[model samples]
Each structure stands twice: as structure tokens, then as C-alpha cells.
Target: MAITKIVELVGESKDNWRDAAANAVKEANKTIDEITGVEILNLTADVKDGEIIEYKANVQVAFPVREQRK
Candidate 1:
């Protein structure tokens, strides 16, 4: 059996939501390993002058839990 854990993360990009989502995972990877997947929770955009200036991604990142030690 394997153990998994979920962590929330938010990322933003000037390009698109896809990049934003990818960035979240990329950043998480800096500290986390054994990543299984990511579930996007929400997507939004920043508006300026009635135009979207940035894309935001809210996601739940899943990875294997670290082993416990005594």
C-alpha cells in the first residue's frame, strides 16, 4: 500500500491558466517529491481596463507521504 497527501497551492502567470497551474507544480516540486498529480481547484483572472492581465490557478497537489521515523 502507498500513502498519499494533498497540499494546496496558488500560482499566477501573465500567459494563461495552464502555465499558472504548471508553475504551481513546478514550485511545489522544489520541496516535494514523488508527485502523483494535481487537481485544479479554481481558476481566475486579474482584470485591468476590462482586460485579463494575469491568470491564476488554485490546485491541490498530491504526492507520496514521507516515511515516518522513530
Candidate 2:
């Protein structure tokens, strides 16, 4: 049997929401392998002077758990 795990990640981008989500995936890919998918949990932003200054993404990353059978 195969098992998987889910972890939450927060990433930010100054450009757009897409980049923010991509950033989260990119960072997770660095240390995680077999990344099955990503789910956008929430979206948020930082405001300053009555304007959206940055974009933020809350995502759930999924990856398979690798273990040797004993």
C-alpha cells in the first residue's frame, strides 16, 4: 500500500496570485518529491495606502510517503 501526507504552506508574490501559488509549489518542490497536487486553501493580500501591495497564497501540498517494507 502507498501512503501520502499533506502539509500546509504559505507563499507570497508581489505580482499576482498565480505567482504566489507557483512560489509555494516551487519552494515545496525543493525538498519534496512525488508532489501529487496542490490545493489553494485561501487567498489574501497586504494593503498599504488603500492599495493591494502584495499577494499571498495558502496552499496544501501533497506528496507520497516513501518507506521500506519490513
Candidate 3:
């Protein structure tokens, strides 16, 4: 049997929503192993002076559960 875990994360970037989403996975990868997939939940942006200053993405990251060690 196999089990997977899902974690929610919000990533921010100065480029675009796609980058923001990718950033989430990249950041997660730094601490997580065996990442299987990602699902983008929401996309938002911060505007300043009539221009987008930052992009934000809400995402769900999935990974397989690892066995525990004592």
C-alpha cells in the first residue's frame, strides 16, 4: 500500500503567477522529498503605483509518505 500527503503553501514572486507557483514547489522541495505533484489553488498579485509588484500563488503539494525510523 502507498500513502500520500498534501501540504498547502503560498509562494510569492516578483515575476508572475506561474513563477509563484513554481516557487512554492521549489521551496517545498528544499525540505520535502519525493514530490509527486502540485495543484494551484489561487493566484493573486500585489500592485503598487498601478503596476504589479508581486505575484502570489496558493498551491497544494503532494508527496509520498515515508516510513518512520526510531
Candidate 4:
């Protein structure tokens, strides 16, 4: 049997939403494995001095569930 798991992660980038999403996946991959896909849930931006400084992205990462063995 195969199981799946989903997790929400937030990533920010000075570039764009795409980079932010990619950053999320890359960061998650540092600790997770078998990453199937990433879904962008929401997008926002931070402004400083009347200019956009950073882009924020909310992402959902899905991967295969890993079971522990005894």
C-alpha cells in the first residue's frame, strides 16, 4: 500500500513568487524525501519605502508517507 502526506510551508524571496515557491520546495527537500509536487496556496508581498522588497509564498508540499518499521 502507498500513503501520502501533505505539509504547508512558507518561503520568501527577493526575486518573485516562482523563486519563493522553489525555495520552499528546496528547503523542504533538505529534510524530506520523495517530493511529489508543490501547490501554491497564496501569495503576498512585503514593501519597504514604497517599494516591493520581498515576495512571500504559501506552498503545500506533498510526498509519499514513510512508515516506521519495528
Candidate 5:
């Protein structure tokens, strides 16, 4: 049998929402293995002087469950 798990993550970037989403996946890739997919939940940004100062992405990251060996 195979199993997968999902975790929510928020990523921030000064560039854009797309970069913010990519950042989320990049961060997850650091600690997570065999990342199967990603679902973008929400996109928001911080505004300053009527300009976007930062982008934030809410995402669901999915990865497979594996047995640990010691």
C-alpha cells in the first residue's frame, strides 16, 4: 500500500505571487522528499504606497509517506 500526506505552508516573496508559490515548493523540497504535487490555496500581498511590497502564497504540499530505517 501507498500513502501520501498533505501539509499547509505559507511562502513569501518580494517579487510576485508566482514566485511566492514557487518559494513554498522550494522550501518544502529542502526538508521533504518525493514531493508529489502542490495546490495553491490563496494569494495575498502587502501594499505600501499603493504598490505591492510583498507577495504571500498559501499552499498545500503533498508528499508520500515512507518507512524509516535505522
Candidate 6:
């Protein structure tokens, strides 16, 4: 039997959407294990003074639920 869990995270980058999504997954991996995949749910941008300041991404991170050891 297998179990899975999903978590939503928002990441920001000054570069682009791809980096934002990648950063979100990378940061999540720091605290999580068995990261199966990431689904990009939404994309947006922050504007400052009529210029795009940063790129933001909403991501869904999926990972396997670890079974507790007896």
C-alpha cells in the first residue's frame, strides 16, 4: 500500500516563473523527503513602479507519506 500527501507553496523570484517554481520545490525538499513531483497551479507577478519586480508561482508539491516505524 502507498500513501501520498500534497502541499501548496508560493515562491518568488526576481528572474522568471521557472525559477520561482524551481525554488519552491527546492526549498520544500529541504524539509521534506520523497518529493514525487510539482504541479504549477498558478502564476503571477509583482509590479513596482509600473515594472515587474518579481515573479510568483503557486505550486503543488506531492510526496509519499512515510510510514512510522514500530
Instruction: Predict model 6's lDDT versus the native.
Output: 0.96
**How much is 5 displaced in model 5, in angstroms?**
0.3
Using TM-score as the measure, which candidate wins?
2
List the candidates' TM-scores in order. Answer: 0.92, 0.93, 0.91, 0.91, 0.90, 0.92
User: After TM-score superposition, what is the CA distance of residue 44 in candidate 1 from its true location, in Å?
Assistant: 0.4
Please list all clashing residue pairs in model 4, or write none if there are none.
Answer: none
Candidate 4 per-residue C-alpha lDDT over 1-70 given as tens digits, one digit per residue, 9 for 90 to 100: 7788999999999999999999999999999999999899999999999999999999999999878747
Better of 3 and 6 by lDDT: 6
| RMSD to the hidden true structure, all candidates | 1.1, 1.3, 1.4, 1.3, 1.7, 1.2
True-structure RMSD for candidate 1: 1.1
Question: Which ranges of candidate 1 are over 4 A from the true structure?
Answer: none
Q: After superposition, how far is residue 15 of candidate 5 from its true place, in Å?
A: 1.1
Clashes of 6: 0
| lDDT for each residue of candidate 5 in 1-70, tens digit (9 for 90 to 100) | 6788999999999999999999999999999999999999999999999999999999999998986637
Model 5, CA-based lDDT: 0.95
State model 4's lDDT.
0.95
**Model 2 over residues 1-70: C-alpha lDDT tens digits?**
8898999999999999989999999999999998999999999999999999999999999998888756
Off by over 4 Å in 4: 67-70
Over 1-70, each residue of candidate 6 has an lDDT whose tens digit, in order, gives: 7898999999989999999999999999999998999999999999999999999999999999878846
